[model samples]
Structure formats: C-alpha cells, structure tokens
Target: MSFITLNITCSEEKRELLIAELSLFPFDAFEETETGLLISCEEADWEEEPVFAVLARYEVECRVERVEKVNWNEEWEKNYDPVIVEDQCIVRATFHEPRPDFPYEIIITPKMSFGTGHHATTYQVLKHQLQLDHKGKKVLDVGCGTGALAIMAHKRGATDITAVDIDEWCIENSEENFSLNGCDHVKLSLGGIETVQENDPFDIILANINKNVLLDQIGAYSERLKNKGTLVLSGFYTEDIADLMAEAGKFGLVHQEQTERNRWAMLALKKE
Candidate 1:
C-alpha cells in the first residue's frame, strides 16, 4: 500500500517532542534525517488536520507527499547496521555477517517497526536484561517493536514470552523477526496490555513506549506483575523519571536502577 509522508523540519531540541506528538497520530514509521524527520502513515489512515495541528503546536515546518510502495527490506538493508551490547548480545539484520563471539544474537528485519537495538532505550534494556535471570521465567514485552526484546528474552531462556504491540505493522515485523531469530516459543500478539488475560501475570515486563502511554498503563502493569517481579521502562526523558517513579510507587513498585543515553532514560522497577 502507498503512504502519506510528512517531512517535518523542526529545531533539534524539539525533534523528540515532535516525534512523540506525531506518534499519538496514525503515523507508522519514522526516520531521522540530518535536518528533521521523515514520518509516514498508511494513506487510508492519514489525516491532514492532526498532522498540521502537531506541527503548529511545535511551530515546525513540514512538507507532505504521497509515497509509492517500495522494497522496505532492501532499503533497510542498505542503511541498517548491527548493534552489539556489552559484547554479550548482538542485534543484526539477516544480510549482515554474524559475530560468533557474542553469546546471544538476534536477527531482525525492522520494516517500519522500532526497537532495532540501535535506539538507546533498546540498548539499555538489553544491557539490563543481560543482568537479570530470564531462564524459565514468564516475560511480557509491551509495545514489542521488531520483537527484539522478546526474541532476546527467548534466547536468554525465558520460557513463556509474550510480545504485544498496538501497531499491525509492528506485529507483522516482530513475527518475522521472531522467526528469524528462531524464537518460535515467543507468542506474538497485536494489542495493548488489556488484551492479555488477567489470569496470567508476568515475572518480567518490558515497556519501551512513550511517556503518556506508560503513565496511562502503569497501574495495569503493576496489576499484571507477579509479586516481586521486574518492570523495565523507557522511551522517556531522564527528567520524567521522578514522575514515573512516583506513579509506580503507588503500586508498590520500587525504583531499582536507571540508565540513560542522549537524555533518554530506561528505568527498572521491582514490584514489592
């Protein structure tokens, strides 16, 4: 299918804000350019008003265009680079040659989906995941873009891994990634946390989505976590940590630690 592309030019300082704001819309994929961002959404879901509204709110300039269907995988292959975390986990595309020294290798084809391990949030989460004991544990990967985290969890011996995302593109991308990594046991689903039944709680939950979605679903995350379970969160600035911690505290989730990269922070919370 074709897509509506929005070439947004904003101040470097406001780039993250614009990305966050645009995510609330139906926009699906984003690529950071030297001067701005390239965002796209399915033509059927594109709405001019919301896009213009967001640009106006940020006081940014934009150019809209209709993008014809292209070979996304081929495009990604040309630009995609492998990411290695702490020399333990490596995330790479199938086209790239493997580095056998890394204990865990996750092969992914991130066609419009996020969480390719190049992002600081995903990198920090992978670093923290290496520290945890996922062997035979039940894991829930919320907003599992590219299913990178979920696949990593499976590689780390997580027995019951459930990866969920609201975007159908993410679901499809994640499924292919899971299969690429030979993570057949990782269950891929399309929806939010509410889609998962309450009867099954999780030992570890990973949420790398935006702040608003995290805030809105903090309670649900707490409810779904088993006693003394772990919750790793990201996709927000370091400044937002205090507020997020305060909300998690209400549900007995104690702040364990945090990692940051380029002002983006990933928080580790433990349910008491």
Candidate 2:
C-alpha cells in the first residue's frame, strides 16, 4: 500500500503533544523536521478525522501528501545511519562497514519496521538486553519490529526464540534481518500476542511496544512467562513507569530495575 505523509508545523511544545496523540493512531513513523513533525502511515490506515481533530487544538500549518510507490528500505537507506548502544552493541545496515571491535553487532535492514536501535526506547532495550542473562534460555519478543531483540537474544545465547508482531511488513523485514544475522531459526508470527504459540513459558520476555499496547498485553505476558522469568519493557516515556509497573504488578510481575534515556524508560520485572 502507498503511504501518506503529514508535515505539521507547530510550536515546540505542541510538537511532542502531537506525536503522543498521533502515536495512538495508525501512524507508523514520526520524524522531527526543522519546522515541525513529519508523520507517515499506510494510506489504507490513514484517517483524516483523528489527524484533523488533534491538529484543531493548536494553531499550526499542516501539509498532507502521498508518497507514491515508495520502497521502505530505499527510503530508509537514504536517510538512516548506524546506531551504537552502550558502545558494546552496534546496529548497522549492510551498506555500512563491519565493526568487529564491538562485542555484539546487529545488522538490520529495517524497511518499514521500527527498532533499528536508533530510537531511545530501542537503544535502552538493547542496552538492557546486554545486561541480562539469555544463555540457554527461551525468549519471547513481543512487537518484534525488525526482529532485532530476538536476534540479540540469539547473539547472547538464547537457544529458543519466538518473535511476534501485528504488521506483515515487519514480519517480512524481520525475517530478512534474522537471516542476515544468522539467527533465522527464530520463529516469527504475523499477528499480535494471541498468534504466539507458546507451549512452554519463556525465560525472558522483551516488549518495546507503546504504553497502551503494553498495558493491554501485560496479562498475556504474565501468563507466558515462567516463574521468576524476566520481562524487559520500553516504548513509553519515563513518566509512564508508574502506570506500567502498576499493570505489571496486577499479574505478580515485580519491578526490579529501570533505566531512562532522553526521557524514554525501560523497566525490568521478574514474575513472582
């Protein structure tokens, strides 16, 4: 499907507010421009009502356009760069040279998928993954964009891994990436949490989806995790910690630690 782009010029304060509101909708990616925020999504999912409703609250200039027949990977290649997390992990594309120095390297061709280890949420999660133990363990990666987290778990020695996402493009892109990283054995599902066929509870669960999605799926996460298993989460601001922790607590998931970067937070919890 084609993609629609919205170029919104609003005040600095309003920029973030718009992002938060638009994120709740079907928008795929948001980029900050010199004038405002540039948001895009599949044309099939684009709705003018929500976009205009949010824009109506503030005084701003908005431009809507259709990007015809664009390839997500090509678009990404033109504007993307490699990301380094904690100086230990390097996320680079095939076009970039290898960095043999870093202990762990995740090569990604994100396409239309997220989680290139560039966003603060993704970076924080990957950094947290480095600190966790995955050796000979089973891992579940919810909202597995680009399959980065699952591949990292493999690099860290996870024996069995399952990754799930609701987007078909993401599932396709992630498969390419997993094969590129030599972890194609990682199972991938093309739907939400319910599509995950977890006959055995996981030892570690990684979820970097937004707050609302995380809240809705926390119970499922709880049921899928083995006792004392770890759950690492991100994709919400630092302030959302209380709400997330509260939801997790409802299912006996105890908060053990947290890390914040540029206002985005990653919380690690253990199932009790």
lDDT of 2 by residue, 150-248 (tens): 999999999999998987878998999999999968988888888775578999999998899999999998889999999999988889999999899
Cα lDDT tens digits, model 1, 99-131, are 788899989876667787867788889999999
What TM-score, to 2 decimals, does candidate 1 have? 0.81
**Candidate 2 stretches greater than 4 Å from native:** 1-78
Model 1, runs deviating above 4 Å: 1-70
After superposition on all C-alphas, the RMSD of every candidate to the true structure, in Å, is 3.7, 4.3
Query: How does each model score on TM-score?
Result: 0.81, 0.79
Indicate the worst ten consecutive residues by lDDT in candidate 2.
Answer: 70-79
Query: What is the TM-score (0 to 1) of candidate 2?
Result: 0.79
